[model samples]
Target chain A: MMGKHAQNRILAYSTPLVLIGILLVFVAAITLTGDKALGRMAAETLIRVVLVVGLWIFVGNSGVVSFGHAGYMAIGAYCSAWLTLKPQMKSLFLPDLPSWLAQAEWPVLPAAVASGLLAAFVALVSGATILRLSGIAASIATFAFLAIVNTVYSNWEGVTGATSSLVGLARYVDQWVALGWAAAAIIAANLYANSASGLALRATREDEAAASASGINMYRHRLLSLVVSGFFTGVSGALLGHSIGVLNPDSFYLGITFISLAMLVVGGIGSLSGAVVGVLSLSMMIEALVRFEQGISIGETQLALPSGAQEILIGIVMILVLILRPSGLMAGKELRMPRFAPRSPDYKTSNN
Target chain B: MTSLAQLFFDAASLGGIYAMAALGIALIFGVMNLVNFAHGEYIAFCVFALIVPSTEAVAVMFLGKAPAFLLIPVLLGLGAGAAVASEYVVFRHMRKATPVAMMISSFALGFVIQNALLAVYGGRPKAISLWPDLNTPVGVLGAQVPLLQLIVVLTTLLVVCALALLLKKTRLGLEMRAAAENFTMARLLGVRANVVITGAFALSGALAAAVALIMATQTGVADVRMGGQIMLVAFIATVIGGLGSLPGAVAAGFLIGGASVLLQAFLPLEVRPFRDAFLYTLVIACLLLRPQGLFAASSAKPRI
Candidate 1:
């Protein structure tokens, strides 16, 4: 018979493993098709998985909705563009880069890591002050951070091309690469969620007064989560820039911010599984809708959805889902393997 | 000095618009914990209501053809109708959900509205002249201000006074105030929850309609995304003013608008485009200093 502690450990890890398995299956299935568009869709979905999972690290644990992660993504994307682009292209488009960065051209892997680190550094500094405020105040402060980042990026012509697209990024990120990052993000999120700080932050989320009274340092835990969350979000941004081979400030604004948040919330913001599931489900629905818009043949008839019906339908579906399941589709429960042995009386599953 | 006077009028006019939008958000937030992200869509909807649905360069005026006396009330009613319908259809069922869920739902609702508008009217912004005579320059306090600026300021003052009277003197207003203060307690004390909530939505929607009319007149162009920028500014204003405080929201709205105008006027030419970045940074600092907000009610504080 398996020991309870071993069983509990298996349960704790099963969530991420299952999520990674789902991603692997998705990648393999798409690869079999060998279709470029399908490959791009799969890669994009995995990138979202990384983003929403990064979001889950902070929002799911701290219960503070951050509208600022996309700002970190912008920082990461720009930093990667600054690092990876050819020196000649940089000089022509982004002439004002400091001498060292202007001359330097790094491989995609190191640049991506460096981008994530830069984003984490920024998150640490910003979250230091912003995380002090609890509840909606913190949420708004994060939003302000996003707005500040967006404005500066949009207008910083010398560096960010000032609303113009920054091209020449190495298109190195494919389905397999995105899958690796998504798996890494899921692992990071899972490890963070099960960490001591994660538990402490969640305690604060559940009952701030009680948690504080019990000696949980809410600020420290929240900042830690934000930093971790920012890192992966930044990496995802780098991947997105590399995948598309172009970066624009507008791409990392309120639209992505809300959509990612929507995915997190819709998938059940409480569990790691929810983040992954939300991205896959929503992405698949969108792809299917796009395909439908492109028209489908059935028995000598062609059927097509209106061009913009997808967005309206998705919005309506989101509303319907919320109305039916307010807590989200996962409802804060992690998917665990079935236990054949009698359960240990002392063992309890962590809900967060 | 004349430039300063001109700046002042410009600031006040812009501030007045934000104040109105912020008030609309604050009203619903006062009664329900939900932040109505769909409020912006209501503004867009009202603006589009003035024009017939067509994907054309020039918008054909539908309600825009009506005289001011008839047009204003009809638009306000349409705005109110939209808000009430949303509240009844979407939000009513979400009463028991968490604030985050409700917020997402509201966002989804706004998305639906925006995309629906996008489908009906193509992506391009359409020009529709409304009260073009109001655009003529008029000297005010030794400054050449657009007549619409003066009108906007005056209309804002009139609306504030009328709202003040209604809130202070009307029975429905008292119930709303009570509900806003403490919904559960007010409900327990026999104030009808539905009536107060519905009244707030109606008032908020009418305010949005008023903003729509002013924006349409001032810009003479109606884009599907036009309301989004103002809505974001107004949302920031609502929060900085203290989420549930009506007067605070208005005050913050004007303050932000004034700051934005001043920053635009005074910032170096090279840095003027980055003015919004500076503005939002100040907003973060403001929140850091006073997380409960500059004008938070005592009840806003949690009893630990």
Candidate 2:
């Protein structure tokens, strides 16, 4: 009954809408349960959605695997901690902070925004040089960037508490708030994937020589994607900090980096839907594993996995998944409504 | 002047360890184009192999009690065995997958290995006394140098020379070199893919074992997480040396090690704690200056 263009437009928007809808339903389910632990799990899962989707903005489009987005998250997290913690608490804990940062305090939302902006600024600076290199070289450079960030943060006594955990952060990121951010991240990732810069970056990812030959500025587009990616990654860091109400440099190091990357790869590294789905599925599995580790009620007795069994099992599962589906579960395809008829040959390829 | 000599010995010893680690990584990457993240776990496994599995602060010697003549070869064999087993179990099936997938798999494999070790050994760092006598300092050029450090340098030199000879003179080496240059072409030329791949894994694993021995002797402490920092530095060296270039990997390993030591020694006390930050920044700068690496192999260049 509708024109083809209208249908196409709806289809284009449907992926993000479906993703957001899925998140909303997850949040509703958690809310209905009214259990604090379930609420915490949902919130953590949504935060990971933000982190992975942020990572996908650059990695999915540019085909550059980053081992450093966690660095941006660290930057955002500490930035929020510096801005939002009580002035009195900051003075006692981080006495070496400059007078301005020492005395100033801001609301949670603005502090998070500022944290994201700060992370974006760092990405812009670092990516300017890093994006010049292509492929694995770029990946290594991002890793170096992460190392630099970690080393600095771990040693910076006055600001980051120097390897000590910074506590007393406002735990404002409940499931609903996290749901809002996750939806925002999905929408942003969807927009970027369809944008000109994103398309150009994807072109380079497909074939750098051909993309350059076609006049795409690989450096600029890559940088833009990285900056946007850095922003959301930073916001996620802030969310993680607020959710747990603690911050540590070690938390944002290789563990989060690899785990988040694993989620992205498992979900399908190429599509927005993959990013969201990857986070949800992997997070749920992890939660279930944790519960099992705690002890499952069997008919006769409680059966519990060993304490570290979850990590080992998850790793094995990841390997099996990669072996079975190299391109990931979504295989780079966005979630879409089922189509009944074959498309006409003249129809333009739908944006994935 | 004595202090300067001491610094040189310190740098060289660290550099030697890093060189071995880098070579291990470079060998695998040359053959398979896979940056085996599990390489670090291999090192940890070898170190852990030297001790009885326990959560106690003081490690009970298992293999560490073996005589030097028997211990070295056994540990090296264990490293090689583990590497080859992983190749057969996990990596062999992934030959057709993209580099990214293989990389993630390697990381997952590492995660599994690390956690398995954690579950068995527990998380506490154990004091491991390998050869306490090796730490005795002897005067050299007016500077006292540890015997272990001198041995590390000599062992690194010996390994490099031996590997050079093997690579230049052996048939397996020729096949490996060919494969590193062009894997498909080497296959077409009748190179046995399994043999060459398995060989590289073996050599790489032995090198990891050597690094583990050196670290265990040097630090006198075996932690589950010990291999991670060295592995990261070695990975960066491997890239900086040119992804597939063996000699370059060794050189960059030494360079990074020397740079790190020098930075630690020369930087002001206030900035000393940030030495790794400075080192990594330099790594980024080096990468930016030469994206193809300081010693790029011909195969590293894109045909397009």
Candidate 3:
């Protein structure tokens, strides 16, 4: 048992250390690429890690599914984008915005936080109505919220561009900024996952009725996690939007929602490490495919499949995983050093 | 009144295709407890099937002089084969997993398929046009119905009736129903569970092929992106009616279809631009109130 525990400790640190090392190497490679595309990828990937880790907080702990995170990301992106782009443009694009919002141009950090807070507030409001339902109902409610948000984004022309918002926001999402935010997101999710309230959330997730009988406020715990996660997702949206330097309602469509979801599922649902692995691996694979097609062909045929076959392949992979290894690659296992955890008591260890 | 008839006819034609697609989706959900998010891609694959014979730029190899009715059966067979392969490769393995896993996998499958399709077909929505009038109307009940609409409605009715009879009178259909109701019990009775379940998926694929034809003819268009939009409607219709009930799904599909038409007719012009909003809101309301669905036999989370 001691040997197994020691092995677990070693295994945990090894992956992250390797990951961090790889991230640095990629960062170097991107810098070497001369162009900033690699840097943008790194920055966007960092943002993805943040959002996905936020997802891990609730999905991992509760084992319940929620689709509303994309909506939160949408809110965050537009909020920050709206702020930093310029007030005159906000007036032009977001004609329906309140007088105050129609005339505003904020800096990077404030705009980002405001976006997060806006999403978190929305989460707070939604959780009150939705958190009551357990399992599929809760999942469905989240989807409903997603649809409503998407509709609003699509139609609410005064603040949103309705279809297009070519905001000339300077590229503020440099690597340093993204790195700091990613660190914040990681720390926030990690702390929340292990906090006192986090424990209660986990308990509720395990057995809601039992957790309630044990005096855990199931709604409160789920809501708390959702609010925190919503903030991160919102920030991710802001950063991603800024990195791309263009924004549109269509950008956050169901397609992105599905890919984000697949990333979490394919990586390993409950683990932060899994989210990282999923994003990095999928991104690289896609990049390689794109690169491969651009470089050479197999005889007369392009060796390329169809346009959306990547999504199909992803679906096939997801289905295969569900059938063959339902728990995902990493399952619920955490990736952390032994130093991060408290030592088990002698009695507990000796008995085991 | 003339324009109104045309609009109704158009909506009905669209709805007919939607209903067929929904039925195909519901059929699999009935037995497997899966929503089959890859359904739209599978439908698109059928169009690809149609495209392949002529894709080689050789018209003579295909039915040059005659309408290639052979392509229809060939495509259905090929689609069924692909569907079964996907089921065996991916979904069959995860049938017993958690909902989160299942749902996520569906999303992944959708993404992979969409991107791959985009890579191959390009971003352009291809015109899968057909001969004669697809959208032109004929009068029915003071409102004009398109011939295509009539064909679609008639196709759905005939298919539904035939499927119902298959489920009732045929041994294979009965075995499928038995398996859907209680797999372990059916298994205990010496039924081959794997064969029956896979057969259900195969049947679903065949139906998808049939629906693809209606879809192609009704719209007078075919594009890879067509499945993404229509699949959601199938999902909403299936869930609102009842997850595993065929009759319920069909009823819901028509009801939702009628509702979408009615919304365009009755909704104030100010709200006319947001037709999808009204359509989805009704679906959401139906789902919220009838999570068990209007017609589903109450069962706990299906083992599948």
Distance from true position, residue A87, model 3, in Å? 2.5
Collision pairs in model 1: none
Model 3, TM vs. native: 0.86
Name the best candidate (by lDDT). Answer: 2
lDDT of 2 by residue, B1-304 (tens): 3499899999999999999999999999999999999999999999999999877778899999999999999999999999999999999999999999999999999999999999999999999999899999999998999999999999999999999888999999999999999999999999999999999999999999999999999899888998889899999999999999999999999999899989988899999999999999999999989998999999999996
TM-score quality measure for candidate 2: 0.97
Off by over 4 Å in 2: A1-10, A338-352
- Scoring only the A-chain of each prediction against the true A-chain gives TM-scores of 0.96, 0.95, 0.85
Q: What order do you get sorting by DockQ, best first?
A: 2, 1, 3
For model 2, what is the error of residue B120's alpha carbon versus the real structure, in angstroms, after optimal superposition? 0.6
- Model 3: per-residue Cα lDDT over A8-59, one tens digit each: 5455545445455556676667778867666766787777776787777777
**Which CAPRI tier for candidate 1?**
high
Worst 10 residues of 3 chain A by lDDT: A305-314
| Rank order (by lDDT, best first) | 2, 1, 3
DockQ, 0 to 1 scale, candidate 2? 0.92
For every prediction, compared with the true complex, DockQ reads 0.87, 0.92, 0.39
Docking class of 3: acceptable
